[model samples]
Target: MATIDLTEATFPETVGAEGTVLVDFWASWCGPCRAFAPTFSAVSENHPDITFAKVDTEAEQGLAGAAGIQSIPTLMVFRDGILVFSQPGALPAATLEDLVSQVQALDMDDIRRQIAESEADAEVDAGS
Candidate 1:
């Protein structure tokens, strides 16, 4: 399947709906982004169960900014509407595949809960 282009208007519904989705934040002008595009696309095809979407920083500035995207080819993986893995860089195909496998191995529910608890702890610490 062709990769989906995610913009601010459709970002939430697409990434936050359900299941595992990997969102690639990229820009057309970026060489690394161009190079990584096909690899990412191939991964999407290889893993039909996962939804792979790309967001063009140039076109989806708001959405990119909201995601705190500071570099081209930032990859974020979400499961069951909660973010699980996030990394910034161009990863080789094998590495990317391994990452997907690692994510699959994780208990995302506990991961998300831990993240929330950590954030709350930080907030409480800051307030004191």
Candidate 2:
């Protein structure tokens, strides 16, 4: 599958709809982002079931800021409409593949349980 070019408008619906999605936060001038593009795209083709999307930070400044993207080439993985991983830096093809495997192996029921517990804790903390 080809990588989807995500704008601020489509970001939510695309990432929220379902399944596993990998988002690359990048800018045109960032060297690391350029270097990582091929690896990301190649992985996209390898996993047709997964959605691969890119957000051009330069164009989506508000979205980048909201996402807390401190550096270029930030990769965020969303599974089951929840963000599972986010980090800044370039990843080699092997690392990307391993990450994909890990993400695919995650038990989303457990992840959801954790999310619910975390949210409950946060609410309790706020009530305190």
Candidate 3:
């Protein structure tokens, strides 16, 4: 599938969708961002089940700010409408592929259980 152009308007709906979503935060002025574009595009074609979205930091400053994007060429991964991974840097193809593999292998049920436990712990602490 092709990468979707993400803006502040579409950010909520797209990221909140129930599936794995990879968002590339980039700016046209950044040389690394330009270089990583083709790599991201190539990887996108291999994963039809994953939704790849691009947020143009230059054009979508509000969205970038909301996402706390301090650097260009940052990558954010969301699974089942929850953010699972976020980092800064232009990763090589191998690294990107490894990330996809790792994301795909994640046991989301376990993750959700952990989150629930943490929230319950937090509530107990708050009551103390």
Better of 2 and 3 by TM-score: 2
lDDT per residue for candidate 2 within 1-128, as digits (tens), equals 99999998999999997799999999999999999999999999999999999999999999999999999899999998999999999999999999999999999999999989999999999999
* Winner of 1 and 3 under TM-score: 3
Top candidate by TM-score: 2
Question: What local distance difference test score does each model get?
Answer: 0.89, 0.95, 0.94
* lDDT tens per residue, model 1, 1-128: 66898888988898888778899999989999999999999988898888899998998888888899988889999887888879899999999999889877888768878989999999999999
Window of ten residues with lowest summed lDDT in model 2: 11-20
Candidate 2 Cα errors over 4 Å, as ranges: none
Off by over 4 Å in 3: none
lDDT of 3 at 101: 93
| lDDT tens digits, residue span 1-128, model 3 | 99999999999999999888999999989999999999999999999999999999999998999999999899999998889999999999999999999998999999999999999999999999
The positional error of residue 58 in candidate 2, measured at the CA in angstroms, is: 0.5
Candidate 2 global TM-score: 0.96
TM-score, candidate 1, is 0.88
Instruction: List TM-score per model, in order.
Output: 0.88, 0.96, 0.95
- Better candidate number, 1 or 2, judged by TM-score: 2
lDDT of 3: 0.94
Residue 15 error, candidate 2, Å: 0.9
